[model samples]
Target: MSAVLISVAELQELLDTAGSRVRLLDVRWLLGDPDGPQHYLDGHIPGAVFVDLETELADPPSAAKGRHPLPDLAHLQKCARSWGVSDGDTVVAYDANGGMAAARAWWLLRWGGVADVRILDGGLPAWEKAGGKIVSGEEPDPEPGTVVLTPGHMPTVDADGAGGWQGLLLDARAGERYRGEVEPIDPRAGHIPGAVSAPTAENLTDTGHFKPIEELRARFAGLGSGPVAVYCGSGVTAAHQIAALATVGIDATLYPGSWSQWSNDPKRPAATGTEPA
Candidate 1:
């Protein structure tokens, strides 16, 4: 299998090479920013198509479905085709902040059965630092593609599955969030019982790139050895955790509903404090 991560220089070479047919998706989004389009217009990689995370990548949010419900497979297929994806073509996704947002596309495409999807390591800054040029405004519409999207390429756990998971269940939120000290967005603060506190931020270095493979392997090693599943405030950052686990040869499942869905329910148990419970 192709690596889930790709470097800036490697991407540049692929884009420069003739007949490479790599699709570049510029997914510029902030949690509360309504200006994703403006961010893309300010500057983006040349020949890159901008994708709307809210509308394209996820379905309408409901308290019951979590903040970022997975998009319907048919809708995602249409969106992927609109972005000019094709069968046998490589897809690369990137965002301004590390690979946080872009990891959504990487995981979605891989889950949807795109064989060769990757995230631009270090994201936009890495591209700039590598001497890759940026282009303002959008490029012309790309030729529609015929890539078929098939789900089940990746593993996932629902709320019930998470609660009773026999293996490792990782909570990819911050310590404060997991401890119920702060509940910024979700209905409730705490985390699902039996889930370990493994914040997604630690997956990256200060430079915003993922840590070395050996380091990542060692980091997860201390967490325990078993089938792994990861969740976050919503489902978004959990994908980042899954990508990091992939780099270390560990296959982790995603909890799409995550805490957003889990907390909304009064029946399900919530655990707070430093311990995993």
Candidate 2:
């Protein structure tokens, strides 16, 4: 019952009692395997709709904007309605890749002004393990939603803002990437200067559910006391970091351009190695 996460049992209750008001989004995506729609077609929650992170969730990429810039607000509104979301609907997003990808939908919907959005804790694996029903093939799209959306509901920072940020800037990429051990898809390796490495994978337990609240609190203790901003390779898993911080009662801003945009700009200095120098 975390503010940003919903348990499988809680989702089941809502489905049983408030079915008409619940909007389920299956946001299945993985870094190398991004064929989300086809994977969703193979199996999904009974009423969940698929959200494509590449197309629906993000704008087309460019050097200045990073790999997954926030979708334009108007486009996001259109997409939300297509998912059958209404102003007051309870939106739940889940993915097979822990909550890594689904958290993007959760963050976007909230930023677009949908209140009460939650990530299904442990995602699909949790659902099935709890004996929750699963169905294959696309469910008929729900009636087009009437949800009205506004941008900037959640905090965000652009490259310049991230560069000058005085708060704790958390780099939510893998430690190896943060250390510049691999370049992968970006123009360079290494993390934003002065940002701390807090990989999103550590947020989960072996069972894939988020760890207990106290444990999370202890994990982040003393990282910083000021405002927090987070970023990952392309701003996707960063949402997962924000979600984890949320469960720990920390409000964080998202750096949408993240490392992708930062690395591409030759003007921006890339700092490698362990120290956040």
Candidate 3:
């Protein structure tokens, strides 16, 4: 199977037998908070290693970049190996915020050519609610290995590329952010001209679980032609959009730099107001 998602029950069943072959990652993170590691130390899924989204998964912030810039490929590969993930391992990632953080790691693994990966449905809360096992302690020593970087699988596009391509530029930020009405996170508030606002939250239900695959397909029906290009503030929440697209068999490329990168460049045109420019 191609990284088939396993529920809490399924994960429990596979725990002992698949210990070595299955790599469980806790990708819980908060946007501007620094207590993720402390929370993980309090408790996490048994045998799961914690992966910090900012320090481990993304590069340092730059003046012209989003808060969570894409990490170096080699560095990511090293982090993968630390969690006991190999090319052949079945990696599963999860986070507290539904699948937002987890999906980012999932997408990154696929981008790195580690195709056998999946997100824990509903994340840690779901697992805990389902009476899954938990462990409290620090992480064990990782068996590190070199990861081969394959950039081809990780498709990305800039504002110019998004404009030129026939594919849909799906903005996954909130309606307010997309409309450039209230600028809270980034210095500028607005979206790329001609991009459609398809908020990532639309893909989830009131309980934080993802919507049904059929519903997702219906929602994104006339967005565009060819592959969709998913973007959001700094490309984090955008992964949730890609996950939704993938659930419905729609393969979309990610603009990793996303709005943070686009807005920083004065040369790039940003569209404000409700209408898609």
TM-score of every model versus the real structure: 0.98, 0.98, 0.94
User: Tens digits of per-residue lDDT for model 2 on 8-69?
Assistant: 99999999999999999999999899578888888899999998889999999999899999
lDDT of 1 at 1: 21
| Superior candidate under lDDT, 2 versus 3 | 2
User: Model 1, range 1-277, lDDT digits (tens) per residue?
Assistant: 2299999878887888933489999998878888989988999998889999899999999889899999999999999999999999989999988799999999999999999999999999899888889889879999999999899999998999999999999999999999999999998889899899999999999878999999899999999878999999889999999999999899999999899999999999999998888
For each candidate in the order shown, give its overall lDDT on alpha carbons: 0.91, 0.91, 0.81
Estimate candidate 1's alpha-carbon lDDT, on a 0 to 1 scale: 0.91
- Supply the TM-score for candidate 2: 0.98
Q: Which stretches of candidate 2 lie above 4 Å from their native place?
A: none
Evaluate model 2: give its lDDT: 0.91
What is candidate 1's CA lDDT for residue 150? 92
Clash count for each candidate, listed in order shown? 0, 0, 0
Worst 10 residues of 2 by lDDT: 216-225
Ranking by lDDT: 2, 1, 3
Order of models, best TM-score first: 2, 1, 3
